[model samples]
Target chain A: MKYIKVAGVVVFLLLWQLAGQINPGIYSSPTLVVTEIVRLFTEGGLLGLVFGTVATMLLGWAFAAVIGVFTGFLIGRYRLASLVLEPYLVALYSVPLIAVVPLLVIWFGIGQTFLLATIVVATGIMLVFPTAAGTRETVRVYDQVARAYCVSGRHFLFKVLLPGALPFIATGMRISVQRALMAVIVGQFLVGHPGLGTLLSDARVRLDADEVFAVALVALAVGAALTALVGWADRTLSAWRPEVTS
Target chain B: MTLAHGKTAAPTRLAALTGPGPVRDWTIRVAAFCALLLAWQLAAQNVSVAVLPTPRRVWEGMAGLLERGDLQLAWGQTAVQVAAGMLLSAVFGVVLGVLIGWFKPVDDAISPLLNAVFLMPRIALVPLIALWFGLQDTAKIALILSFSFFEIFFTVRNGVKTIENEFVEVAKAYCIPQWTVLRKVVLPAITPYVMTGLRLGLVYALVGVVLGGFFLESNGIGGLIYALGSDFRTAELIAALFTVMLVGLAVNLGLHRLENLLAPWKVTR
Candidate 1:
């Protein structure tokens, strides 16, 4: 199976290279993309652009995590609060967050401010649903346990509820990683900010297929790395989970 | 998912707060909404009216657009693209996912490619898509389709994987045909998972379609937002955004209702 997978990728790459060779103007080969990537790194400030995007993405994610987890916890704990806020929350959560980016761009003026706010709102709203649902489940499961033990509210919240919901929060965070990244990139793309998205868009304008592929490769690498990091966090955080017997 | 749960409970909560009567619940909910508007009005005072418009002004802007029929035109364009793209992906994604999962060789060949594509940020490809498709409805639909497809595909694949080997063996022992097993067992088993995927996909599709509108400079809610933003019409921008939110909430609620009707046993809180 592993060999088949490896061979499949190799065949795919070969076909792509062949297609590029046949239509060099429209398509770009792997070799050309590699050359462009190396050039971008050495001469084109690619690292800075990458870090700029990543930094903004991480910052937005941090804010989203804090706000989402806190609000979700509150909603889970106080059914009354959940009742009052649920409709608005659902409306906000369901809204195509990308649709709101222009408003942020208008409000924050097409720079890091717009980018960060867009990233935060997009990722934060996505994070809220899972975390809140997980928290609700935790509350349901642990209510009797906490009552039987006569645990204090704080104690029940921190020790029983939060821990029980950690796996769910982690899952939510993991899902949001991809979304936050996309939001930031699209935010930059729309606003013409100086990031990987800008680089990609610039290349598109110049009709530089190789340059586009180069920037995309970097994005792919970063995306894969972030996903791995989230997966690692999920595993470490969920060590107490029954599925982790190993 | 939980957001959808909140929508249904909202009416009941209002009743619970005001003692079991529809009128009382309606009054309480209206009061809460009024309080929110009042808070917004107060907050708007602190900022430039151009920066954060008062709720009243935003409502008026929405009302004006509605009266002029512009809001309907923009909303209809976006709605059509989102609905079409999501439906197409839902069908194609489930079929492809099932095919890949039901056959080991297919899975081995395709899983690696899917993983690679899935890990890559798709927003980076938007410009390329625009360049290729030229700022048209095709580009908008393509963007929505691309995002929705992978979401549904991955979820359905996982659903298929969850089917224990024993169940398949039992079916085979009872002389069940492959297609019949797939229809009776696999389809039913994956219904809930597919619905979950479809919900998430719907969200992504909406985002993609809206962004595509902004990118393509089309006559959609996103385009209206872009125009409002450029013109510094903050109130109108906010109004358009509110419209988008309403459309999203309505679609989400409708899907939730449909899911409940289709599989009553799978009703999730």
Candidate 2:
């Protein structure tokens, strides 16, 4: 299966190679893309820019995850609050994060303020759903168990609800992290002169197709890596979930 | 995802008063919304109107636009694009998803390829789409269709995949025709998944339409936002954003109800 997947990828890469040649003016060759990636890595000093962009993404996503989980857990445990907050969150989520970026820039300034807001908005929506749902799913059973032991609301919420909701939160986090990347990219495209997206926009101005593709690919790699690392952490900790408590 | 669920409830309020029973619920809910409005107005105080338009300004802007008649055309333009895109993607996504789930060969051939393409940030495809269709409504429609297709497709495939083999065996034992088996058994079985996907589709549908509309459509709220953002008209940006969220809130409610209505089997007694 791995070999087949590799073969499939190779075939896909080959198709791109052909497309590149068939229309070099519009689409550059894979070889050119590779060269551009190397140049950007070596001469362009793009790593710092990558870091600059990534830092906000990480920070913003972390902020979102923390708040989202807490709020979602709260909502799930408290149906009344959930009922109240649900309408607005859904409406907010339905609107594209891209659409919200301009608002962020206006509300928050163009630099870190805007970037963090963008990241928060991007990642924020996913957390609410999973945390809330997770709470509901396991809240009752776990509450029953806790109630038999005369557990407090805080104990029930922190210990019982949080545990059961972890898997769902983990899943939502995975999705949101990917979305955060997209959101960050879009936000940065508009506001970031120092981030990878800004680099992408710069390339667009120079009409540097290869560099544009390269910067985007690098960003994609980072995004994919972030998601994989999160998923890996989730899997590793999953077995040990029973051993840990809030 | 639970993300969709959060949209149903109202926002929070700062007021300390709490009554009992259903009255409390109603009061709290209304109070929450009012509090949000108050906070928004308060928050806008220090900021420039361009950066944060007051809630009243947005309302006035919306009302003024409505009075001017441009709002109707813009709304119609966006709605038509979304409707067209959703209708097309729904058919293709469900059919393709079903085919993949039902046939091993198709599943083997398609999933890997599609998944790979799915990873490619498709907003990048906007230029390619624009290049092909030019700066036209078709370009916008195409983008919408593309964004939504995979979402529905994956959901439907998951839906069909979840169908129990034991049920299939029962169908075979009863000598049910293939079409009837699919229509009666498989379709009903995946209704929830489809509904769930349909629910999610509302968000992405707007996304697809907005991206195209902003770039291509002459009259959408998206284009308006982009224009204001570029010109740095902060108040206008706020008003435009507020409108988008309001419209989305309404659309989501309608879709949620529709999903519940369509999935008659989701008996939540």
Candidate 3:
């Protein structure tokens, strides 16, 4: 199975190379993409672009986390709040946030603020559902235990509720991180912001397929790294969950 | 006895305040909505109309688009593209997902590739797709497909994986044919996932169609939005965005109803 997987990738690359040879304008082979990536790093200031996009993504994600978790906790803890807010949250969540980027650009202008707002708008609401669900579930399961222990108020919220909801919050974080990355890239691409997305758009304008592919590869790596980082955080934070549950 | 009755009354009142009731819920929803609108109105009054249009301006803008038939025309184009692309995605995604999930060799060869592609933001490929397909409905549909296909494919593939091996074993022992086993065992098990995929795919397809309108060609609501936004027509842009949001909410609610009807036992989020 392992050999077959390796062979499959090799064959896929070879076919791509062949295709690139035939239509070098549209198709970018693996080797060419690698070369372009190295050149981009060395001369194209790819690091700065990466930093710009990632920094915006992370900052926006942090804001989203705070807002989502707080709102989610409130709604989950209070039935009246949930009844009033859940529908709106669901509607906001379902709406393709990309649709609002243009509106955001107009409101915030085509720069870092716009980019940050886009990321927040795109990815923030996503965290709400999972966090709310997690909080609700935690209350349902542990409310009695906490009551029995004479726990209430902030002590209950911090020591009991939040800890119990960590897994769900972590899951939300992981998912939101992915959206954050996509949001920043697409935001920069649409607005011509100084990021990897701009690099991609520039390559597109030049009709540099190899450079586009290379930039896409860098984006993929960033996405993967963010996802992995979130996963790691989730695992580390939730390590105590099993012991508590048991 | 009077003191005990008073205590009971107090607790019951508290319970009523905290508990779910239809009348109270609707009242709260309406009140919250009004408050939100008021807040928006106040904020809009403070800001430039070009930056944040008042709710009334947005209403007027929507009416203007309606009068000019721009809203209907653009929405119609987007609807057609999204529907067509989603239909194709459902067909191809299910077939490919099933094949990959059920066959070991295919899964081994293709799963890694699929995962790699899945991790890459499909939005980043918009320009590349535009280059290949040009500014046509084909590009729009292709973009939609690229965005939506993975949700259905991955859902169905994982659904197939979750099918109990014992069921397949029992079918084999009973001499049931492979196709019958698939129909009876695999299909039933994965229907919930398919429903979920369709729900998710519809949302992603909306995103794709909007992106296509923005980047590829300006024919749909996305194009209308892009045009309005670039011109700083804030009122019209908000109206157009509201339209998209309504469509999304409607699709989400509609699919949820359909899923409940089709797969009542499977509660999906």
Highest DockQ among the candidates is held by which one?
3
- Please write out the lDDT profile of model 2 over residues A121-217, one tens digit for every residue: 7778878887887788786667677788998677766777777788778777777776777677777767655777676567655655676567656
Q: By descending TM-score, how would the candidates be arranged?
A: 3, 1, 2
Model 3 agreement with the true structure over A148-200: per-residue lDDT tens digits: 99999999989988888888888788777778888888888898888977876
Model 1 per-residue lDDT tens digits across residues B1-269: 45655575455665555664556656656788889988999999999988999988998998998999888988888888888888889999999988888887888877888897789887766666765666778878888887889988988887787774747889989999999999998889778778878877887787777777766646677788888888888898888888788778877888887877776775432
Which should have the higher DockQ, number 2 or number 3?
A: 3
Note the DockQ of each predicted structure.
Answer: 0.63, 0.30, 0.65
Better of 2 and 3 by TM-score: 3
Runs in model 3 deviating more than 4 A are A144-151, A242-246, B1-20, B164-166, B267-269
- Model 3: how far residue A120 lies from native, Å: 1.3
Q: Give the TM-score of candidate 3 (chain A).
A: 0.92
The residue pairs found clashing in candidate 1 are none
**Candidate 2 falls in which docking quality class?**
acceptable
Worst 10 residues of 1 chain B by lDDT: B1-10
TM-score of chain A of each: 0.91, 0.88, 0.92
User: Which is better, 1 or 2, measured by TM-score?
Assistant: 1
Instruction: State which candidate, 1 or 3, has the greater TM-score.
Output: 3
**CA lDDT, candidate 2, residue A243:** 38
lDDT of 3 by residue, B89-122 (tens): 9999999888788887988898888888788788
Best by TM-score: 3
